[model samples]
Each structure stands twice: as C-alpha cells, then as structure tokens.
Target: MEKVQVSPSRTGSHDQSHNAKWGIAAGFSASLVGIGLARFAYTPLLPAIIDAGWFDASKAAYLGAANLAGYLLGALTGRVMAQRSSTAFTLRAMMLLASVAFFACAFPVSYLWFFVWRLLSGISGGALMVLAAPAVLAYVPPSKRGLSGGIIFMGVGVGIAASGTLVPLLLQQGLKQTWLGLGIISLVFTAIAWKGWPKQDAAPVHAVQHPRQSNNTTLKALYAEYALNAAGWVPHMIFLVAFIAHGLGQGLEVGAQYWVLFGIGATLGPLLAGVLADRVGFGLALRLSFILEGVCVCIPALGLGTPWLMASSVVVGAFVTGTVPLVLGRVQELLVHHPAQQNAAWRTATVGFALFQAVAAYGFSYLFSYSGGNYALLFLLGTGAIALALLIDIVASRSVDEAAPR
Candidate 1:
C-alpha cells in the first residue's frame, strides 16, 4: 500500500470536529434529561397527582413551586460548584442527580419526599442550564456556536413535546409507572452522555481581568432583559391551557391541543432562532424575537379567534425556548475570550430568570385570581413586560455604542 500520512493539522481538525459533536450531544442530553424531563415532566404529572389522590390540589401546586425555588438556588450555586470541581464532573453529577430524583418521585412516599425529590431535580436542571452549553461550546468553533447552542437548547423543546405526548401514554400504565418511565428515560440519556463531555476540565478564570465599565452596563441590561423576559413567559406557561379550556370555553381537549402546538413550536424554535441569529447577529435576532413574541403574546388578549390563538400559542412557545440560546449567545459575544466569565455570567442570567419566573408565576397567579380568572389581563401584562425588555436592550445598545471609543 502506498504510504499516505495525514498531516498533524488535518488530524487535529478532525479530532476537534469529532469532539465537538460528542460534546454537543452530551449537552443536548443534559438539557433533555435535566430540564426537559426533570422539570417539565412534573407539569403534566401535577394534575395526575391531584387526581390520583396522591396530594391535594393546593399541595400539588406548592410542590410544583418547590422546583422553581430549587432552580434559583442551583443557578446561584452551579458556578461555584463547577469552579470547585471540574465542569465535566459537576455536569455529570447533576445529570445523575436528576435521574435519581425522577426515580425517587415514582415512590411518592409523602408530599415532603416528593417535594424534596422535585426540588433536587430542579436544581439539576438549573445547573445543567448554566453549565452544559458552555462546556460543549468551548469545543465548537466560534462561527458554529449559534447553531450548536440551538441544538443544545432544542433539548428543552424536545422535553416539552415529550411531556405532552409521551407522558399521556405513560400515564396509561399508571402514575407511578409514568414516573419510573421518565426516570428510565433520563437514566438512558445520562449513560449515553457519560463519556461525551470534554476530557479536560474547563479553562481557569483569568481571561478578562479588567472588563470595561461599558461591559458591566451592558451585562446589567442583559440581566434585566432576561429577568423581564422570564416574567413575560409566565402567563403563557402557567395559564394558556386554563385560559383555553375554561376562559374561552374551548374545553380541556382543545386547550391540550393548543399546548401540543406550543410544544411543537418549542421543539422547532431553537433551531430557527439559532439560524436567524447566525445570519443576522444575536443582537438583532434577539430584538426581532422579542418583537415577534410580543405581538404573538398580545394576539390572545385581542381575542382574535382560533387561528390567531394558535399562532399566539406557537410563537410564544417558540420564543420562550428560542430566547435562551439568543441570550447565551449574546453573553458569549460580550465575553468572547472569557470562558469562565461566560459560565459565571450565564449562571447569573439563569438565576435572574428563575427568580423573575417565580415572582411572575406568583404575581400572575394572584392577578388571575383577583381579576376573576381574567386570562387576557395576564397575557397583556406579559406582553408589556416583553416590550419593556425590548426597550431596555435598545437603550443599552445605544449606550454601549456611545461609550465605545470612536
């Protein structure tokens, strides 16, 4: 055979590409199992728990909130844990913890026990959201990061869709069986992703020792935008189904169908948004997303009709999942060379998101009750929050430009 030697550069490139693929796969799995299955799977299960007499409706609602609280705590602490341990270790540990939590939930020994497990699962999801993409993206070329990030976040959508579709089928086998089924699925994903993380630990945190003041201002703006965006998402996430089912007199089946549409939109959103971001830039893509989502969010409030309602459900669902990667991508753009800082900043963003999401959940819940189940009010408020987020980003962009040395 003729001697054919591969050049070192080509071999290295091939290795890098291979590693990036596996790393992205791992990230996808992490998000799917941690956030998708761990957090969202609980939503569909909530009514089941109430119906099964496992817990009263009030207790079930409180139990659901426990996960949100744990998510906030996890976001606050994930970066610290990653710093102390390796990113790979922490990421793997969180995935494992999430799987374990799902299995434990199957037992439902008591409300306290279920709550603790649910809380732990939310913590796993929070940590994964903060850590997984950065870990994987470190291996991806900068040019391809937008699409790769979309792929990673697409897991959330997949999880959402699965919860809507699969959970019902799993419910057929019984509630405990459904929990076990989710746990098994999670465990399978964990095993597949076990060795997919990058072999080396993440780079140390010395990239940007002295970030500029403008960067600080921009970051604060991003945080506020993200927080408010979370608030904006609350109405659709919490009330869309009920609004359709009872508020519109559409009935439960029709409401669930809308939710399925939301899930489908969510599943496709990240990819579409990522591609748009890649072509138009994250900043512009993000602004466009907000505008589109804001409009869609208000459609229901306008009482347009079924087609418009469907559009609202789908677009809002898409933006809810799509905005994640756009924000994360924007963070990377802001801190291009600082991997550690990127992780830390993303952690802060996730914390803000979780915090505001919880607040909005409660606030909107109260408004819904106080307003006598006025779903349109909640949707309009959500739109206002999104519009405010857009305004903040616009102002922040101009300020950053003005502060730049021309």
Candidate 2:
C-alpha cells in the first residue's frame, strides 16, 4: 500500500482505522530497527569480536565510550539544527550515516581509528534516536498519541532481539566477516527506509511559551532532571559488558552469549510496558519499569549461572533502558501547545543526559578497575539509581497533574 497522509480533517477517523494504527506501528518499528541496530548492536558483538582475537577488550570499551560522546554532541547539534530540517530528511540522513559508520568498523584499523569510527557512528545513532520518535508522533493523531508512542518504542525491543540473534549466528561465520555482513545489512535497510519514508507534514504548532525570561526556572529544572537520571544510568549503560567480561573472567564467547540473553530480555520489556501504558497511564508504566529494573539488576547476583542470569538479563533489558521514550512522551504532553518549544526542550534534556552519561562512563570504567573488575557493585549502583529515578518520576508526575489546567 502507498503511504497515507494523516490529514488534519481525517485525524479522528484515521486514528481509529486499523490501517493507520498499523502504519504507524510499522513505520516506528522499521525506524527502530535502523536506529537500534546501528547504535545498540555493537554491545553484543564487541565481545565476540574480541574473543576471536581481533582486538583488545579495553579498546572496545573505549570505542563504546567514544560513540556515546558523539551521541551527546549530535543531540546538541540536532536540537538546534533539526528543528528546521524535515523529518523525512533527518531520518534518512541519520540512517545513512549510521550504516556507513558501522560498515567502517569492519576494516582492520588501529585503536585510535576505531574510536573515530565509533564516534561518528555514535553521532549518527544519536541523531536517529532523537528524530525517530518525533517523526512517529507526527504521523499519529493526538488522541492516539500515548498508545502510538508506546508502540513506537517497542521497536527498541525488536532491535535488541535482532542484535541478540544476529551476533551469535554471525560469530559462526568468523568475526570480521560477521561485521561486514552486518554493515551490508545496515546499508540495505537504510536504502529501504529512504524509499519508504513518509512525506513530511507542515510542522506541528507545538511550543510552550514562558514569560519573557523569568529566571529560566522551568528549563533549569528540566535539565537537572535529565542530568540526574542520566547520571544514575550511565555506569551500567557503558560498562555492563565490560563488567561481565571482567567479573566472570569468561572468554569473549561466553560474554556474547550473556549479551544475547540481555538483548532478549530487553526486547520483551518494552512491549509489556507499552501494553500497561495503554491500559493505565504513562507515569505508571515508567514507575513499573523502574521497579523491575532494580530487581533485574540485583537478581543476577544470586549466582544462578546461565538460566537465572538470562532471566535477570531479560528483566533488566525490559525495564531499565526502555523507559526513555516514555520520559520524552511526558515532555511532549507537558508542552502540547508549543511543538517547537517542546521539541527544543526535549532535545536539550537529551543532550544533558547524554553528556552526563559520557562523563559517567569514564568514571565508572576507572571505578571498575579500582574494584579489581568486580561487576556486582555496578549492579548495586544501578539498582539504587533506578530506585531514585522511579521516586523522582512519581514526584514529577504529581506536580505536572497539579499544574495542568483542570
């Protein structure tokens, strides 16, 4: 079927129509595949490649950090420049950059060069992450916005699952060839997405107006919120695999297997959260996911080996990382009247979060070294941060409700 525009007049009817709902879901899912595979697949694959004796594990960790740093920079750039860029164009450009960057990783290069490729990939991946949901939201009607947002994020899970399945299968084909094949896959999908991208609508009229520069209190608070949450999550986010590799003293192959399990769990968490959000509300979904995140991180400490570890991995994957889009959804809801302002605000929040995450990555890596590569403490830290984030969300949601027009 050809792409159907969500006309202003037909917004209500189209929202209820099965075709519109599915189209939004399909588009979001496809974009997620592009974004997630390009950005996230590396975590699982790195260990496999390292175990194959292709590179040092420390270099892989640094490369991951470099990519995240690029992501922070890209989010800042996008928030400023992308407001005027067409959604279709932004999505296509990001995917193309990601595809080429990942493909670049396949050629043997020095550690410094590898970091450069990862950094470029990071920026491309970050741009995709920031743009994908907004593009998805533009196509969805306001009435269905929450549900659509949930479905769009479910794409993250699918991407995670794909990485899990793809890495192990490719490892059988040899490490270098596997990366080359993955790059080819990225390139092919980018082409397909470019061809199928929905046409951009006139920009949505959304922006919250602040009084002519009152102390920037609200903006400052939002930045603080993003920084706090990002700080809490960054340690595990950057070094989870490294923690696993060092803690268990497992070979790269063993680490890859666990990473695959983590991906599988991550995939399921979002879908379940989406369903719950549709039934309850966005705030409740986030809280539940956060609670599960704490449990998931702590459960692996029980020393149950592969099955228990896998179960914990899935639970961890499901809750911890998946709540990000829901957080963005809250930002959208907060600025329903000011689309541009809201977009800028969200971009700002993301940049703040990404920067904190980058800083945390380096700190946590050194901390892990100091602890003699103990991974348990990292999980402990993750659990505490997740608990705090959940509490903050609850408090923030209550404030939003109180402040909104009755």
Candidate 3:
C-alpha cells in the first residue's frame, strides 16, 4: 500500500483554525479576570478593610449584597442590550465600565463609592458570564466541548486564585495603592482582550433558536434550579471573607486560604462535571453534581475545622460550581438543529437563563440577611437548596427521556 502525504495547504488551514479557536478561548478567559478577582478576593480582604478602618464589617456585607443585586439586574438586561448590539460590543462596553468602577476604588473610604463600584463590577461580571460561556461553547465541535468547557470555566478559578495570591501582596503596598493596582490590572487585561478578540461574520451555528414545544417547562425548571442554587451559594459568595475572618479569627493572610481552597475546588468542578455529562448524559450528571455539592455545603458546618475544612471547601467548590457547563451543553444540544431564525428561540432561552439567575441572586441575598451573619446557617441553607436542585434534575431528566424522538 502506498502512503499518501498530506498537503501543506491543508495543514496550514487546520493550524490556522486551531489558532483561531485558541485565541477565542483566551480572549473570553481574559475577560473574566476582573470579575473573578472581585468575587473571590473580598472574602480574604474583608478583615483588613475592616481593621484598617477602610469600611465597617456591615458595609462590606452591604456592598457584597449590592453587587449580587447588580449582577441579577445585569443578567436580566444583558440580552436586551445584546439585541441592540453584538456580544463583543456589549462585552467591551461592560469592560470599560468595570475598569472605571474598579479604578474608582482608589479612594478607599467612600461607602457610597464602594457600593457603586461593587454594583458596577457585578453588572460587568454577570454580563460576561451570561454571554461568554455560550459563545465559547459555540467555537468548538461537540466532540471536544467538554474539554473546551472546562478550559473556559477554569478562568473563574484562575482569577480567584490569582487574586487570593495577590491580595496579601497588595495589603503590604497599602490599601489605596493596592486597589489601584488591581484596578489597573483589570484595565490592562480588558484592553488586551478587546484588541486580540476575533470577529466572525457568522454567529455560532447553535446561536439561532430553540424548539417551540414545552419550553415553558424548561424555563420553569431552569428558574427553580437557578433560584435555589443562587439562594444556596450567593450568601456564601458575598460573605465568605467576613465569615472566615470572624469564624477562624485569622489574619487576612490566613483567611486567604479559604479563597485558595474555593478556587481550587471550583476549578476542578466544571471540568469533572463536563466530562461526566458527556459520558452519562446531562441530567444524571447534574443530579450527581447537586448531591456532591449538597454534601460539600454541609461538610464545612459539620464541625470540620482548619486544613480538613479547607479540603472539604475545595471538594465542595468543585461539584457545586461545575454543573453550569453541562446545563449550557444541554441547551445547546436542544437548539443546535433549530430553525434559520435561531436568534428568537436562543434569545428566549437566554433570557430565561438570565432571569432565573437574577431571581436566585435576589432570593439568596434575603436569605443571607436572615442568617444574621452565621456562616453555618448559610451553609445549611445551601444544603437544602442542593437537595431541591437535585430533585429538579431528576424530574427534568425524566421529561427529556419521555419527550425523546424514540
């Protein structure tokens, strides 16, 4: 048998597309840095901010809650704005706004200013999340989607972990300058992403539409799942830093460990779940994720202390957060073969996605407040939410199977 040699042109074309895909992934990941840092950094920095008289403990709490509120609002509003423009355009706008909001923190002591910036950051972050994942998913083939999804979500963990490492260094630089540095970093990253990000004349194939069947059911179930998860996790997101500070009586440096653990766990969660979903199907993967998360949420409160506690936090973080890609993948599978004007159906599902997340954020904020600053209570609430989410997964899975073309 004669062996055939591959042509240089074909090899070049393949290489070019590979490069393009990698570029898109990196651009999307870079866009997440500011939000990731903001979300995870404060948990460690809260203690220092309070002790240094930068702000009160209560003010930090309020700022976090406000940020989540803005995130909720941003989610509901992002696609409407996207309709007026492109996701890239919207992303650039949000990034510019986020940069300004972050840099505004240079003043350090203005309660109102902090609140404003936090909220703005939340909006930028939320919009990034709502738009980025789906876009990233679109660039790759179905066969490699699990790996691609993991790579995309890793940005969240990377940003969080980087901030954890950086916050302590910033503290040494002093508060005002530290925040200013972080703000500058955000600006630089955004500028780089804006310049390097690719523009395609065609949108992703799956971007078009969803089926007109019982989408209402999908929407309802999605809303409940998002709401419950948000309720379960948002409080922890906002207050984890403060909780660590007070609960462990550790200095800021030590408190950074929680974020370190959380980031590590969150990093692993999406990758593992994506693979599981690809293998076992989306619904069953989601159910397992929720169960793992439920256990993880409660583990921290089961009187596990210190290093063991950190281990649990990491474990919990992985499963708790990893379910997102699988969910998005399921939606993509449903909509991939839809009609020519796929934007309408896609928009409907996207909008539902945003609103569900918003409701979750809002409801969870209230739950956080009601917990009266008790971390254990917050975790308990998360545990319950996970249980409900698991139930939703089972029901939704059964529905899909029953509704199958068979």
Per-candidate total of colliding backbone pairs: 0, 9, 6
User: Candidate 2: misplaced stretches above 4 Å?
Assistant: 1-34, 79-85, 205-228, 231-246, 249-254, 301-308, 336-340, 391-406
TM-score of each: 0.88, 0.81, 0.84
C-alpha positional error of residue 181 in candidate 3 after TM-score superposition, expressed in Å:
1.9
Range of the 10 consecutive residues with the lowest summed lDDT in candidate 2: 211-220
Q: After superposition, which runs of candidate 3 have C-alpha atoms over 4 Å from their true positions?
A: 1-19, 204-213, 216-219, 334-372, 396-406
| Candidate 2, position 285, lDDT | 66
Which candidate number maximizes lDDT? 1
What's the residue-level lDDT of 144 in candidate 2?
Answer: 75
Give the CA lDDT, 0 to 100, for residue 368 in model 2: 60
Order by TM-score, highest first: 1, 3, 2
Q: TM-score: which is higher, 2 or 3?
A: 3
Candidate 2 has an lDDT of 0.64
- Per-residue error (Å), model 1, residue 166: 0.6
> What are the per-residue Cα lDDT tens digits for candidate 1 across 23-49?
999999998898877877676665567
